[model samples]
Target chain A: MNLYVKQTRSISFVPKSILAVLILSFFIQCFWHFTFTNFVAKRHALPEPPKASFIRLASLDDSVSAAKLLMLWLQAFDNQPGVSIPLKELNYDRVIQWMNLILEVDNKIQYPLLAAIRFYAEVQDEEKQRKMIAYVSNKFIEKPNERWATMAHAVYMAKHRVKDVALALDIAKLIRQYAKGDNVPYWAKQMEIFILEDMGELESAKIIIGGLLESGELQDAHQRKFLGQRLEEIEQRQKKGE
Target chain B: MNHNLLLTIAKYSIWEAIRDKFLIFILLGFITLFCISLFIGELAITEGLQMQSAILGSTLRLFSVFTMGLFVITSMVREFNDKGFELILSHPVPRSSYYFGKFCGFSVAALIISFMSFCCLCFYAPVNMSLLWSFSLFCELLIIIALSLLCLFSFNSITISFSVVTAFYILSRSIEAIQLISDSPIVASGSFSYKFINSMLDVIAYIIPDIYKFTQTDWLVYLPDVKTDILIVVSQTLIYVSLISCVALFDLYRKEL
Candidate 1:
């Protein structure tokens, strides 16, 4: 080749090499990401947590913002035209993915968690509803924090969403353990009675009500009268056991 | 190949940007907005500092991209349309040198923006892993700057150039969503029409920058768990920017200007 053509060819080699490397690296990164999400997704070895761009805008540490973003994304599935139609048509797996991210980010946020629980229950996604309750219990209530309010919310979710009265009672008892004040323990006692009654554990529930009444914990006049009536009903049932 | 000439032109471009009123205004606005975000973050239930950092990081990315595109277009227009470029071309400088010099100048401006944003973020949040986000933002801006330059050189009209750059920005940011559409069952395994559309999307996907992979915004929130692959990001950015720069150089060489 002539000197000019040789120089031109030499210069062209640089960009050609660079282009090949770029394409190669791009595919390698893609394959790496694919393997991660498919194989290591369950292993939790994924390098980066993936989320919808809009939802990912919310910071992970900020559960409040995460909750807010989750709510907004869920609102897309509500009863509205143009927007809801597309979102509603989304596969259950897609909705589950969004829910899993939201629950992962902010299991302690009250309104959002409650809303998610209700939505999953309404959609008859029993597994997801149970998973939401389990997440709240595990991440929030089970941890060492003054999470009485959060525990109460979780108990409420268990009762309504999963209809697991026994599980709700266990959570209510766990709340009683973390209760630092008289007020929350009193509420927990009440929740225990209600859940036990719902579970058809009437004998256990009656015993709890009797102990609560005997300890004079139901000092509020209206509440006392209510407990007194409950005691009377239990006593009547016990006597009718012929 | 003339490194000294490229540095000189680049230094001049940086000086021009430093003196530009828009840069000053943006800097001031960034500081004010960061402070406002801190106060707004307090209203959050927990992780107030994380919230503040995220807001600042995202806003910085968006503002930097917009301003870089605007700056590249207007600067190119000022140089070419106003015959300012003739003064530089009168010298023995190559067209590629001039293009690379302008890119270097924009890169400096982008670095300054990233540094300022990171400084503001550090004022309220921890800087352990958050530094990765600013670095990624820098890489992201480098890609934008290169794209802006490429579009500016190819399309002489500022309006067309700006539109193309902005569209690229939006598409790159939405690459994941586009991939989802292509991957959806109806599209992936559907009839010929859907398959054709999916094929077209696949082609477009290959062309667009993957902006989603560049974002490490989660680091601004949960530091311990978020691992940003800086190697991949840096390598991808270098390759993309270099490729785009070569394209701009070739186009400018063919131009009769």
Candidate 2:
């Protein structure tokens, strides 16, 4: 009888200890979750994008889908961890890294390059805007034929957003210089002339228009006519200034 | 080889998948995941439908793989457990026919799933791209099926076979990326450990199928070189499937059923 009682006591002791620990664990879990739920900082914590290697590995050989998914996540980041984080307060360098990492997964996808010009460039920070513009410009030079539109947008962002006409002109010229294929429409290079004109470099613009007209690269008669009129207009403006 | 007998066994395998309600599970799981994909698409700031198609395409691709693997592993394991496998061998059927028939049956089932996924996604993605994606997915499935048979015949346990097959799929899929990581100059370079790791990855990559080349989600978005991609998938599928099937055959012949 004593032996049976001792065994029962031993078994009961385990349950009692385990039950106590289990109940204690429930409280611990609740406390941690509550703290986490309440204490997340969104503004200071634009997420560090996952490593490129990790992205490629986790993608299961479907790098394109992985790239798109990361793009979507970055887009929705205005609302991260259930809070609305203003883009200006976020670290732009980290944002650039995320874009680069997404491209590393699948370079064929244009989403990241597009996002640099269209999405992240909206930040109120001038430096962030410039950084985004530079990101797009660099990406454009890498595959100028593929990313001409992005470069055009970057030119616009630099000229208007960054208020840096010189940088815009540089990027605008890169579109024509790097793109050798006919896939880049003729109009993409016209931005350079416009930016040069905007910068009050009429001689440069005339030289460009003359070179283009003589090169017979302008297939469309309308484009050729526009350049002719533009050259005369630049000459007239130069004469009046003189 | 008795063509009729081979076909009969193949038909039996199909019937087994049907009896297990494989199609029904596929349909229900696809619908649920697809709806979730749509929900995610709605959240896209732009390209809502493109997002939807990409998400659905990728998710369904993976779902098909998981279900197909589970079906192959569980169904074969059931045959082993029930002694049905031995029952077939009790007759005068060539063991190669048995293996080939089972392989053909699973492959057909995989094709059906691929078709279903294609049809559902056609309205969303470009037709050419969707077709290529489906074909490549089918080829990918063929490799997995062959690997599954090899794993089952070797391990003969559902748990181990499933685990091993899953690991192989993962490693093969990511092996290219793993190789890149090991060879990356960003880390401390020229170290003995780094060189060893790189060499090991290179050897492993040579053995495994470069699954990174298969079932590219980019194919859905971009206009792929259809002829070239098809050629790649076909050649790789043929080589890998043949090799894996050979290994499975060797393993099966050695067993005293």
Candidate 3:
């Protein structure tokens, strides 16, 4: 080869060889990466959820994005390498803490509540379900009108997921006690009466349904009529029970 | 490829950057981002200053990369179009020498940005963590500078070169997330497409530098369990930057300019 060609070939050969070695190191790091590289190892490791205050700080006041990002990471956490941990298998304290943090970060979004209902509460373990329900129940106390729906989900978890009417009634009663304002949908307040009927407490259902009919908060004629019908149905059930 | 010639080229390039008001722009940008972070910092429920510094640090890191990338690409392309390369090549200098000289000049610029980030962040985090974060940022910038050089030499279009470099940076930063998701149960297994995709992702992951390991914002909030070692940081930077610079030098040699 001419001198120019020879020089060019030499330069190219060095770079190509360097690239080969660099690539080889990367590949070696992939299979047995912990031997040298923390990148691959860190990728498989689940991060401990940070404190809510710090998360809020890290978000730079963009609570909406912060909440969504946390929710995504939390939901995706159960799927680890080679083996997926069931949602029920997760650390309930951390999961609950994450939900609390996320909710605190952005109260305007229902993302955490949705996770509580759809993902966290849907677990097969009754104890886990109760924990999630209790979390939702307590969180609802802060903003009843906005959070009654999550409590309703908690009520569902109690009634269906945990198969405990008492716990369901407890959560359902919270909707009645705290969700008193008209701005909160009456349907939320009505959950308690429905749960009472489900529990075969016809007298209790009758009293609540009757009280609601007389409370004058039912501005909508349709709601009044629905409660009126519910009262009659409870009375009919009560007579049959006697 | 006289050592003095390479050093001279590097010196003049950095002087030219100062003349272009590049340092002033970076300083002003840093101040502005810090101020914005300050206002947003108060909005945090806790650790207002810590949040401010972390935001500022990460933003400065990104800003440095962008400005450096633009500076290198635009400057090189302008020189190439102006036949400045011919003027320099006529001085008994090899193409590899000129290419590496420019890389050195850009490396200095990267160092400035990383140091600024460290100085601004030291108040919020432990000095060692800030140092690691800043050093990681510097290494990350070095990779970008080298990659930008290769891209500019390869594509020769400002738009195309910047785009490819940008895409590479983004992929490197987020590639870990992609690999992690694939490793998780998110992707359905027992299918050819899944396995094939995973195999491809694995290879790509291995080929690229692990950028997600660098300049992490979490380092500001909580002390990481596995502290990123400075040894790995330096090694990865050296390997990737050297290999990329070599490739750029090789490419430069083939160009007629």
| Candidate with maximal TM-score | 2
Q: Write one digit per residue (lDDT tens) for candidate 1, span B5-92.
A: 8898898788778656556867887977887786656644444566566566666767777887888788888888778788888889
A1-242, model 3: which lDDT tens digit per residue?
A: 12122223545656777889988988887878656544432234444666554554444333444565566667778865546787766788878777777777656556577677667888888788877787777778888887787787788778886889999899888898888776788777889898888778888888888777887768899999888888887788677877
lDDT of 1: 0.68
Error of 2 at B211 (Å): 2.4
The per-residue C-alpha lDDT of model 2 at residue A132 equals 84
| Runs in model 1 lying further than 4 Å from the true structure | A1-111, A114-149, A152-168, A172-242, B185-189, B224-228
Better of 1 and 2 by DockQ: 2
TM-score of chain B of each: 0.92, 0.96, 0.93
Each prediction's total of clashing residue pairs, residues at least 3 apart in sequence or on different chains, is: 0, 0, 0
**Model 3 chain A weakest 10-residue run by lDDT:** A1-10
Fnat for each model: 0.02, 0.62, 0.00
Per-residue CA lDDT of model 1 for A1-242, tens digit only, reads 12122223554667777889989999999998888755322211112335543343333223434544454445445434322343223354455555556665554434344444444434555666666566556544444254466567778877876787777888877765555455454555578777876776778878888887787756678888888898788778767863
Error of 3 at A226 (Å): 62
User: What C-alpha lDDT do the candidate models reach, one value each?
Assistant: 0.68, 0.83, 0.76
How far off is residue B251 in model 1, in Å?
Answer: 0.5
TM-score of each: 0.60, 0.82, 0.55
Measured as a fraction from 0 to 1, the native contacts recovered by model 2 come to 0.62
